[model samples]
Target chain A: QQPVQSPQAVILREGEDAVINCSSSKALYSVHWYRQKHGEAPIFLMILLKGGEQKGHDKISASFNEKKQQSSLYLTASQLSYSGTYFCGPKRGGADGLTFGKGTHLIIQP
Target chain B: EADIYQTPRYLVIGTGKKITLECSQTMGHDKMYWYQQDPGMELHLIHYSYGVNSTEKGDLSSESTVSRIRTEHFPLTLESARPSHTSQYLCASSGSTSGKETQYFGPGTRLLVL
Candidate 1:
């Protein structure tokens, strides 16, 4: 099943912070995050593994709550470069393919 | 940079035409995947392969078929294209199943079926 992402879209001013959340009904082995700019493929950001692991990249950080079957990505002190659509890909069991959330469109305005 | 390549950055074709989207990776990754995405939408996995000669259908049912004839190449073919197939096709590869191994994506092929 596809995960659910909250706040389908968000707008933030420079240096502001924002959070994008992803929740799934199924048990997740890992949660992967990626950001995609206009007309481009997604770029890997971070991966949160099971057993409550956290990962970060630059000002972007994410945490996976296994018990809640949810993940949250944090963007701190946002920059214009941070404007993009963020997707959460969840890995269930031993499957190679990931189930992705609809996506959260983030806009950082100067 | 990761060595994943996709050919034909953009393609426009008429209905009933056959088309193949090419994807290649030099990272020696064992797993490759093909995903379809519309503008401002989430990626939907259409097909994937674990290794050479191994192919599997993803959660989303697709009209496309893929081949893993070699380790570096995984191509998706549509025998008959339709307007519904108009979207961006992304190719990705991962080194392992650990999830920590980030999946590297190609630039993608944007197809417009008229």
Candidate 2:
């Protein structure tokens, strides 16, 4: 099943913070986060496994809740380069293709 | 940079014409997928292949067919193009089933059928 993401859009200023949430109706084996710039392919950012593992990249971090089947992405001190669409892809049990969220458009200005 | 490539990044064709979107990856990954997306929209999986000679339809029912004859190439073909088929086709590959193994995506093929 496709995951639901909250706050379809957000605007932030340089050095601001933002969070994007993804919740799945079914049990998710993993949650993957990706960012896509205008006219560009989605780039993988981080992945949270079923075991409630957390991963971080630069000022970006994510936490996975196995019980709630939810994942949250945190962007600290956002930069102008952070302006893009963010998608959450959840991997269900034995599922080959990742089910993607509707995505959240993020705009960061200086 | 990702080694995946999609040819003819932009295509505009008439209805009833047959078209093929080519996707090739030099990464030698066993898993490949094809997804369709409109501008500023969410991605929808259309097809995927676990390996050569193994292909499966994704959650979305598509009029297109895909072939995985070689490990490095996974191509999607539409028997007859229509305006509804117009969208961006993205190709991606992954090394394993592990969640940590990030999937690399190609720039994508943008098609416009009129």
Candidate 3:
């Protein structure tokens, strides 16, 4: 089943912080974060595994709670370049294909 | 950027036409996938391959077929394209290491069935 994303859309001023949440009905072993700009393919952002691991890069970070079957992506000090639709794909294992959420639209204004 | 590539970045074709979308990756990844997405929508996995000669249909039912004859090449073909097939097709390959599974995507092909 496809995961569900919260706050379908969000608008933020530059340097502001934003959070996008993803939840699945079933337990997930891994959650992947990607950002897709207009007219471009989705770019890999971060991956969070089970065991409540947290991962991030630059100012973007994510936390995974396997028990809750949910993950949250944190974008700190958002920039205009960060404007894009963020997707969260959940997988049970490495070989299992991902089930992506509808995605959260994030627009960072200058 | 990923070494993966997809041909025909954009295509406008008449219905019932047979078309093939080519995807190739030089990263030597064992897993390759095809996803369909509408404008500003969720990605739906249509096909995937574990390796050469190992193809699988994803959760989303698709009318297209895929062939994995070579490790670095996976192509998707539609026998009779329809207007419903008009969408963005994304090709991705994933590499795993120490529990980190990262997928690299191609620029994608935007197909418009007329």
lDDT of 3 by residue, A1-110 (tens): 99999999999999999999999999898999999999999999988888999988999999999999999999999999999999999997668678899999999889
lDDT of 2 by residue, A1-110 (tens): 78999889999889999999999999888889999999999999988887788889999999999899999999999989999999999998544888899999999988
Pairs of residues at least 3 apart in sequence or in different chains that clash in candidate 2: none
Query: In model 2, what lDDT does residue A44 have?
Result: 95
Model 3: which docking level applies?
Answer: high
Interface RMSD of each: 1.4, 1.5, 0.8
Query: Model 1 residue A12 lDDT?
Result: 98
Report the lDDT tens digits of candidate 1 across residue range A1-110: 99999889999999999999999999888899999999888998988888888878889899999999999999999999999999999898654788789999999999
The CAPRI quality class of candidate 2 comes to medium
Q: Write the per-residue lDDT of candidate 1 for residues B1-114, one digit (tens) a residue.
A: 889999989999999999999999999998999999999888999999989999999988999999999999999999999999999999999886544667899999999999
* Model 1 chain B lowest lDDT segment of ten: B94-103
In candidate 2, chain A reaches a TM of: 0.97
**Candidate 2 segments exceeding 4 Å error:** B97-99
Residue B17, candidate 2: C-alpha displacement in angstroms: 0.5
Pick by DockQ: which candidate is best?
3
